[model samples]
Target: MKKTLLILIFLSCIVMANNLPELGDYSSSKISENEEIFIGRQILFQVNQSDSIIRDIEISDYLDLLGKRLINASTDPAKKIEFFIVNDSSINAFAMLGGVIGVHSGLFLASNTESELASVISHEIAHINQKHISRFLAQQERASYQSTFLMAVALLLARSNPQLASTTMAGASAGSVQGALDFTRENEKEADRVGIQTLNNAGFDVRGARDFFTTLKKANQFSGGAAPAFLQTHPITSNRISDIEDRLKDYPYKQRLGNQTFHYVKGKLKALLGDKSNTKNILEENIKNKIYINEAGERFALAYIYLMDNEFTKSQEQIQWLFDNEQSNPMLSQLYINYLIKTNKVTEAKKLYIQNLNFFPI
Candidate 1:
């Protein structure tokens, strides 16, 4: 029965891929937009069922806000885009079918500024907008549903489990489908070109693209080993960074401040996902040494840790300090709300929720 089901799925995908439009007279072409969306949705359904996704509302909202800003600045503003945060700690982001983009939390931990994160996102968005994946598929005249299915599975496992991804790739070798999965150098260069333009249009610092790629190149050089998964997939070279730098010369120099939310989300991820004892120790050490430039962020992170540890009074104290300092951040407000609810102060939580709604109505 299972074998029969798999055969049916394969037949359906073959039909779908065949129905896709041809690449025109050009050597390269793309699947239809509708087909791309369909494939994306199928992959996304699998992704949703996996343990790799981060389902936090706050993190989701922040990523959506940042992603939408970049998407709005892209050449096609009307295109629907979906953003997801993968729980993996690997420094990677990937664009999938149907304008779906997945960002690993490690990407956030690796990025020094919001612009750095945005730069990567913009690049992925460029890939989707340029239909690079579809074009690659079009180039594979004998593209099969089996190959496509394995490609999606490989990508889903890439950041979360490289070993599994490698195993899947080896299995896919039965069909010689690996070549269908790689983006061409031309596609990479085009994405870089259009991505920086999108960053600039989005009012982010374009230097971010250069700086982020440069950092990755340097890290890859010093690792004394195989390239990281991100570099393995994205394949950064010295020329890529140089090209971005050259493009930077055309844009007016502008210094954009990093978003406060970026720091907050980073802290939250650390407290929530990092080693518990280690996270507590690090927060304590930072507090003791006064190490953070943004002390409120430190306190906010500590409060989250405290909440996780069930040190209710300590959590309240930290939250109160943030409120006292007039931090007024939505994240902090949510923390306060959570605290109130936890302490059985439902009335207070309700009142606060009403006040927050009044201040920032949807």
Candidate 2:
């Protein structure tokens, strides 16, 4: 009986050992808090500096809520995730290893609904939750074991070969930088699986993940060779979409998000990018489609477009609506001042400018 018990115990130990997460896998292990904080700050700096067209508080706040909901479902629910929208007009979103995820403002513009944004956010969140970034960093550290020695040798070589030191530093820095880390094809596949799982658990439409990738594939084809920055880093391939779709097949039921706000935001973004002369054509289509909630954003967009077209009278009519509203944007105030000055409304413009200056400085 004692011998039989020992055999069972040994088998149990073997099973437990097999279950342990291997090195560089996205399991429950954690890096130091200081390291997380350090990386977080760097990501914030990068996000702020990166060029983006939509830097509005309203858009960002909406994203924060969605992000928080998704992150709450993750194993490491405590990790604070920051989301930023890049100004560039590209359908790309990426996560910087240290809990920073950036979605291009163009993504919002392109996305037909909020689920599309959720798809991008969920994928990025998976990258962070799985410690994919840190795992890549650890690998790079191992591969560049001779980096210190190479740096010293390069400095010596720089005397004879001026390019040596610069090249070495560039290579070493690229390896270390969180944003520059490129996942292996295997890691990417794992991220896709986990990302879909996250989207499903968050009650978001997992099919949006598939659809978004399809859109990306189309965009990439159009780009020929010059893919957007997001695509440049987080590559989109045919297999990626197929693989995500396969995983989503297990969850057959589609998730529905009935919020009208997404249409409003997208319509606003369209107006911001579309032509002022054709505003009536575009807005009429939206109205015909019964997109009344988006009317405010479209109006605001037309107003900005008018300012750009130098249509002062039409612009004033648009601004009048903005002024009558309780919510005011300081930047809009500055723009109004410009419109006032341009149209030679000197006295009224001066008063508006002074009020804005006292309340909100440029």
Candidate 3:
């Protein structure tokens, strides 16, 4: 069939990549490391200039540390990683050139544990580690003549390589491109395959990947057949779930302790975004009934919600709970400062802020 041939032609160059020993290399690419870095810089510049990027210091710092931890366990331990959280509520995350990974805030809220979140980061790292950059760029030039194939390639790479995607979409038919979108499921699968191993190496529970996929699948059912933004970008098929389950079988079953910071970050998003009343009730009930990820994080969320509601006394009570055990949390420190300033404690807030400069200097 015409469709089948087009898929084969477009993927011919990348097909043999499956049997390779290395996860592709910079030496074989026409785009040099410097060129890739420059491209990444431009893309990040565009992203930063956009209003959608979260400029929160606490969230950004946590993401940077979490991503770097996984990168240290990667095949290229010394590889530099830049991670950012977008302000969008959509469930999406992407990796691009120059070791850049951007995660949407909704994805952070959707993640249940540190390992689930790390699985997503690990998958993106694999995309860069596997050098989909060079292969995608090369495919763009080679497959340009066929409009449908080119469109499929661009759409497949849209989340990972948007600049190329924009250019490719301009000349192709949107109506026709859907047939060829499956061009890169192999690439996605490979990312998953490579990601879990790195995830395990990084000492995370690989089951987080499997559970996250199940979450996506369940979210899809109530989506009116439209799918989440994440599902659109990272298409999860039944086969992919089976593949993950099989890969998971290779690892011994053991629980990985969730990080307190991870729980705090998740709780932070819950309090700040979505339904405030619903989030407040959830946080309060979870804390009172002892049904929370980390009780400290739950109290932190309740404190944040109380602060936003101008319930300073109640907020301080929650902060005191966290203070009893964790007096050095960055997110809590910021929240406490905000609460202090709101209650006419500027002198004290400024003093505390100055004191934290040495430790929480982000």
Candidate 4:
């Protein structure tokens, strides 16, 4: 029975390997674009089956918009990209095959501005644009099948049982795994270099990348525990920060203002992930202490919490304050419309929508 089971597994592996697109030319040390897309689709199918993805429409729409902005600025603007927000709270983002990008919810909580978050997206998109994953697979000449299978398995296991995957990888020859890590590190550096240019070209504050790394480093130090998954994968060093800074020196220094939508998304994520009471308390405390640079975000958080809690009266009051203060803020306008619809005030919602369309005829 054991022998038969083993044979079945082996045959299945062979079948899977055969179904994959032909490996890129070994002599050229490259995987063909079609093969890369096929591998990416397979990996994405596995990822979806793991049930680790967050399916919030608002968050998904925001990430897609942000990702496409960066992709548009990349060398390969025409490449199709898909973005997902993972349910995990660990501060991490990764790019998989076929222009797929995953962002952890904790990353939203950790980021201070839209540009900070965009920096991470830009980095992941750069990895995809550069074909780092496919290149890495192409480099595994001897155990390509086993390595590819293990990689997919590792990704599926990462969210649920990372230790198991780590142990499995540790069983491999140290030299081989270490060489892969070294290559990944080199990829990280190249992604950073390319990502910074993409961020700048997309009209985001370039300093956001450096600022985010600095913040992550500080958080890692003060936590007195394991580094966040982002650092574990991206490996932030002082030299890395310095390299980003040096690149920044080439451009004229300009501070880009934070968008209202950035804070709105952050608040919405916090409300969705955190307990209502705790979120409310935290937002109140931040408002009381003036912790945030913009007081508007605190109000937005309260509004979002109220909206989630079905406290339409409170939600409307908070959103109204935001609209009164920032008349041009589209996010606030949308939220208010949502509130009106929820309260069965369709007439009001329709009138507001028409007014907005007239004012901003895109």
Candidate 5:
């Protein structure tokens, strides 16, 4: 599962980077910087120690790059944020005491655009910057730091092991339990305000955040089913919706950067987690009917599906076509190189691999 010892990377980056915010910066006084870092480290330790993290390097790097871009635009660029994807298929994400955020694979599949996903990350980054977790987790008189630490870690484990999460969270008293599960309403609003700015600074379509939330709201109301895991914690109230919409009006709309990278990654992720036959049928039908949000992404998924199915020639066809438009996309390059080797063009594959290795190292 990549098994990169996430904590080590987080610490090393923290040590190397400057301008990191103090724990007391906009946070409660109860938790010191060391204590917040310690809690974040423990949570990351559990994340790497667990077997549920996704093993795909592409997904891992895509998240890392996306997250870092957002972080660079946030209040704390040198915060050394760590990103990980859990294997669970729940449309949720959460932030903890430190600059730690985890995204569920289900969130990726559910998010139609890169901006939509980035909006969530932007919100989580705001939560971390506002020190919401440290303030909320440490301020409770009845809950000690140890108890709060376990509660935070339990949140990371919640997707992988609900029983363990429940048991670990039991250490905190009843009053703290609700705080552990959800942020305060005011905290949610603040996060949205700060996150929207972050999104704007990072050049994402600011409306992407609103679109995702609106879709979730409609889906929940129409289905009469429980809200997605994200909504369950980050409750989208009527006020929250109105506030977000009103906030969006502050910025004039314009053309945002193309989401080609987002589309490519999404296509790859869909191929990684989707049901093979069902996914293939959908992609083909989308192409035939031209009923796709991004035609390039659908074709990218088709190539991935074909390659995984060992249809080398068909995969080659898609790769050649994609080269015309996305010649420099690392994911596409990786797929093309793999296609070359699989089709007994190892010499050409090796040369191409070396040529692009330095540029798209991720």
Candidate 6:
């Protein structure tokens, strides 16, 4: 009876393999697409730790606007690029299965210009355009099938009282997990190639990809433990930077500067990063240099810094300026409330807090 049951199970496995869907065709189906998006959204939500939701929206809209322009310019117009700006300050961006692309807020600030931002977006889009996700999925399916076979055999053994099934299943699962991660390195390389082309095709500065990676390398060294989540998945390397430079030589594109959005976002991001002394130093320099794009951001930084430094009087003044002059930004408003409380103006702080909650109801 055991032999007969084993034979039946083997046959069933063979039948499943024969019916296994082609990755390309399977991914085309709506159900497959939805599953990918769902997974991407869940992963994004689970990892978010930022206190500012408004900042996320600001960057998300900016990236989407830029991404749309680039995606529209692609040779294959049917490819869609969906953008999300995550709250994490990590210098990372990720493209999940399907067209879902996410950028960490830190990535926005880390970039020096629009081209740098485009470099990251282009890389992610390249992943989708190259069908990297589908390829990875196909590889995963094979490993999963192998794992299932091993688990089935182990279950059969356990039924006979050996009780090794759980251990066997766990080992097989670990192998499958490692296989998925191993395949990601290949996917990243493919995306890097595609990203450069996307940048060139979209009329962005061709050197931007190399430059962004270079900056990220420095940032990784500095941040160490606080490194962005993106680096954890896509390891940076000197070879990769060299490869990007080599690829750019083949595409002799004209140098065109990026847009206003890049400057705006970059400035805002810097204000979020530093403490009072650091912010004041940067802000003073920016003001002296007449860098208006970052002016509002400098103000926001100064306001937050004063609040943190326990100068309630100065904090109140700065917060008031932000409240009066800046647009309805949630983070700036939250900063104001925080500043008010630090100053011992609890009554005023309470009112502002209530107002903030009303304006940005959770």
Candidate lDDT scores, in order, read 0.74, 0.59, 0.70, 0.71, 0.75, 0.59
Write one digit per residue (lDDT tens) for candidate 1, span 1-362.
02233233334444554564553443234556765677778666655655657888888999999999999999889989888887766677888767888888888877877888899999999998998866655655434554454444344444333433554446443244444344667878899999999999999999888778766766667667656557767766678767777888999888677677888888788788869778888888998899975677678788998987889999998888888885477888888898888888999999999999887665
Stretches > 4 Å off in candidate 5: 1-29, 142-145, 157-175, 218-224, 325-327, 358-362
Model 5, range 1-362, lDDT digits (tens) per residue? Answer: 12233323333333432233333332334777877787677667666756667868877888998999999999888887888887666577878677789888878877877888999999999999999877765665532444455445445444233333455445433324544566789999999999999999999999988988866766568657866778877867899999999999998997976768778877887787758889999988998899988888888989988988999888877778788866478878888887888778999999999988798763
What local lDDT does model 5 show for residue 197?
95
Model 2 CA lDDT for position 217: 61
Q: Give the clash total for candidate 6.
A: 1
How displaced is residue 115 in candidate 2, in Å? Answer: 1.1
Tens digits of per-residue lDDT for model 4, 22-83? 44445445556765666667656655544456776767877888888889999889999887
Total backbone collisions for each predicted model: 0, 2, 0, 0, 0, 1
The 10-residue segment of model 1 with minimum total lDDT is 1-10
**Can you write out model 6's per-residue Cα lDDT over 7-60, one digit (the tens) per residue?**
343344445434534444332223355545544443334224223323446555
TM-score against native, each model: 0.85, 0.61, 0.77, 0.82, 0.85, 0.58
Model 1 scores what on Cα lDDT? 0.74
For candidate 3, lDDT tens digit of each residue in 84-176? Answer: 776656566887666678787878877878888889899989988888655665444332223322332334345533333344444444334
Give candidate 6's error at residue 1 in angstroms: 53
Model 2 misplaced regions, further than 4 Å: 1-31, 49-54, 142-172, 175-181, 236-238, 271-362
Please rank every candidate by lDDT, starting with the best.
5, 1, 4, 3, 2, 6
Model 3: residues with Cα > 4 Å off, grouped in runs: 1-29, 142-157, 160-183, 275-278, 281-295, 325-328, 350-362
**Candidate 4: residue pairs that collide:** none
Report lDDT (Cα) of residue 18, candidate 2.
Answer: 43
Where is model 4 more than 4 Å wrong at Cα? Answer: 1-29, 49-51, 142-150, 153-164, 167-183, 353-362
